[model samples]
Target: MQHLEEQIAHLTRTVEELNSVVTNQQSEIDRLTRRVEMLLQREAERAQEGSGGVVFGDERPPHY
Candidate 1:
């Protein structure tokens, strides 16, 4: 029937739109994940070297 066909078309469009949004979100998530991993690796490397004269939150200030 014409009504059934119209419903199918609408549903198809909705599905395709959702698929596009999900794909974009996935790409963004992947990019962010890579950035986080790179940052963690860099921090680890820094730790392996020395504290680099960095101060900790709990420690007293240099003027103390």
Candidate 2:
């Protein structure tokens, strides 16, 4: 009876510790996910600002 109670207490503490670890990991993951999303959004906007690759035939090239 006492031994069982001790085991339960130990297991409870372990579960609480694991829950804390999981919570911290989830917070970190959320931060990273937001950062990645912001980076991708910036990249998308940058892509949108680029030229469409075609230029007029009369335009001077870079070698000029």
Candidate 3:
């Protein structure tokens, strides 16, 4: 029926829009994941080299 067809079309469009949004979100997640991994690796390397320069709570830096 015409009504059924219209409903189906609307549903299809909604699904497509949702799929696009999900795809974009996935891409952003992947990008952020990569950035986190890179930062972790960089931090690890800095730690191994003993040059992390990380300040702990209540601990004054050498320059201060």
Top lDDT model = 3
Sorted by TM-score (best first), the order is 3, 1, 2
In candidate 3, position 12 carries an lDDT of 100
Cα TM-score per model? 0.80, 0.78, 0.84
Off by over 4 Å in 1: 56-64
Per-residue lDDT tens digits for candidate 3, residues 24-47, read 999999999999999999999999
lDDT: the better of candidates 1 and 3: 3
How many residue pairs collide in each prediction?
A: 0, 0, 0
Write down the TM-score for model 2: 0.78
Candidate 2: global Cα-lDDT? 0.90
* Each model's lDDT: 0.93, 0.90, 0.97
When superposed on Cα atoms, how far off is each prediction in RMSD?
2.8, 6.9, 2.6
- List the lowest-lDDT window of 10 residues for candidate 1: 47-56
Tell me how far the alpha carbon of residue 18 in candidate 1 is from the true structure, in angstroms, after superposition.
0.4
Cα-lDDT of candidate 1: 0.93
Put down candidate 2 lDDT per residue, 9-55, tens digits, no spaces.
Answer: 99999999999999999999999999999999887877798843456
Task: List where candidate 3 sits over 4 angstroms from the true fold.
Answer: 55-59, 62-64
Better of 2 and 3 by lDDT: 3
